[model samples]
Target: MLDRLDQLQLRQLRSALPRMLEPVMKPNHPTPEVMMASFLQAVDKTNKDIASFQEAHLRLQADGVFPRARASQKNSKGLKHWRASEHPDWANPDRKRSQIS
Candidate 1:
């Protein structure tokens, strides 16, 4: 359907589209560059907020607010296979003898 529009119709629709967008522009519409600048300001603020959060997190870690992690014998590293020859209990798996011999 959009493909059917001629150049003039496309131009007219392009002019009207921004007005349809939320925070609707009316008699005096802001240029696309102006909208982009507003968007950039928001992004800058978000970046600063993230930086502040990251700095606070780093401060906490440096001050040892969180306990230091200790490694245990079973502390997860990765899968390991133990030999049955070394651990005899594992050599013979549980088996049920015949109820009636």
Candidate 2:
């Protein structure tokens, strides 16, 4: 059973765990603690997977897998909008109007 768990892909862990635990878990088996540890491990694995995916995406972007649009220097209209930040002060009525301009 443990060998089967080791073989499971990170994506398969969620569905496999509940089914495996249901029949074998008992009142005095300390299953809850074991389950919690398993749950944490799954969460950690998921986070690592997401981080790896994001890194791969960034690397692809850097490699120009997706091209970014080039901005024209003569286009002041488009440039002003791009510089607008959503900082707290940016929401102020005075700053909001000026920032967009």
Candidate 3:
């Protein structure tokens, strides 16, 4: 039974081997200039994408909506709280705590 299984596996492998090697049989045809142009176009597109992303990110950051989530603010007990000390007004010397009327 083991010998029959091994023979079946060997036959399957032999049939699949030629298909795997088929890709290596073809030759690349693009000229160096064409390749360079394609590469440059791709690089330019990537740069434009990055620039647009950065611009959008900057705009979002300016509007205080860049991070979009507060999962990182959760504590060990899964509670989220804002720390007043991290705010700019917390360190202001002239700022006085006012009682709510």
Candidate 4:
């Protein structure tokens, strides 16, 4: 059935998606800065457009296909800062590290 075929393809794509995102993920900082929230809002309709295109093809429904990158807020020296949140390491700059070995 076409539904089964789509499910299988979805599973495969899910496995490969992370590999594709690794390169795009920022190692030290979250990209597209949170200060640009207003900018992103202006283009919020882009996703709908992409989904419509995919629907026309009837292959992949890419409504939420892409991973969203975000930043966590941290207070440092009385100042608020944003850091890349994809990886755990950059999330909390002041987190205590323990020996795991």
Please name the candidate that would achieve the greatest lDDT relative to the true structure: 2
lDDT of candidate 4?
A: 0.43
Task: Name the lDDT value of residue 11 in candidate 4.
Answer: 50
Please identify model 1 stretches exceeding 4 Å from their true place.
Answer: 1-29, 69-101
lDDT of 4 by residue, 1-101 (tens): 23534564445444554443444353554555742553444344444444544554353233322222112123244664455664567545455444232
lDDT of each: 0.50, 0.54, 0.51, 0.43
lDDT of model number 3: 0.51
Model 3 lowest lDDT segment of ten: 1-10
- Model 1 over residues 8-94: C-alpha lDDT tens digits? 544544444343343323334468776666556655655565555556556756765444433433564774657877776543435
- Candidate 4 contains a number of clashing pairs equal to 1
Candidate 3 versus the native: TM-score? 0.38
- The weakest ten consecutive residues by lDDT in model 1 span 17-26
| Residue range 9-57, candidate 3, lDDT tens digits | 4454445544444444445636766655655665565556555555655
Q: Residues 26-90, candidate 2: write the lDDT tens digits.
A: 44546667767765666666666556555655675676544532334444555554444645575
Ranking by TM-score: 1, 3, 2, 4
